[model samples]
Target: MQVLTIISGVVGIATSGTEVWHGIYTLPLPVMIVALLWTGARTREFFAER
Candidate 1:
């Protein structure tokens, strides 16, 4: 899960330039958003376990 977030974040940053300059959205953006949400939910569950 951690690895997924790291990879997605990298992808997000890479594609962000195109998104900003061209004012267009791409596939990676949605992937990144899903990865981020998944990571957040996982973290929340981990803390809740305690």
Candidate 2:
């Protein structure tokens, strides 16, 4: 899910340090940012309704 992307991104960066390079570690950031932006408003509305 999107939440996992965010968590994994944070963990990957924190644990990997400067070894990311042009690899999987670099992937999570764009994916996480896009996912959050794509779903943010809807998620907020859903929670606000509750």
Candidate 3:
């Protein structure tokens, strides 16, 4: 799911052409990147908790 989100976000940004820098397409990339980092940080704890 996380990988899919990143892939789709990149695709969306890439396909945006001139609008690639627009907020709608650009905002999620940073958010998702942060999410990926957060997930990596928590992975061990998350599985341990599960």
TM-score of each: 0.33, 0.39, 0.37
Which candidate number has the best lDDT?
2
Q: What lDDT would each prediction earn against the true structure?
A: 0.60, 0.66, 0.66
Mind sharing the TM-score for model 3? 0.37
lDDT of 1 by residue, 1-50 (tens): 54565465566667777545332234456567666776886768977855
Q: Model 1, residue 46: what's the lDDT?
A: 75
Stretches > 4 Å off in candidate 2: 18-50
lDDT (0-100) at residue 18 of candidate 2? 72
RMSD of 3: 4.6
- Candidates' RMSD to native: 6.3, 4.4, 4.6
Give the local distance difference test score of model 2: 0.66
List residue ranges in candidate 1 displaced over 4 A: 18-50
lDDT of 3 by residue, 1-50 (tens): 65566566677677867665563555676777767777874676777755
Q: Per model, how many backbone clashes are there?
A: 0, 0, 0
Q: Write the per-residue lDDT of candidate 2 for residues 11-45, one digit (tens) a residue.
A: 77668767545346566667867777768778778
User: In candidate 1, how many Å is residue 11 off?
Assistant: 0.1
Superposing every Cα of model 1 onto the true structure, what RMSD results?
6.3
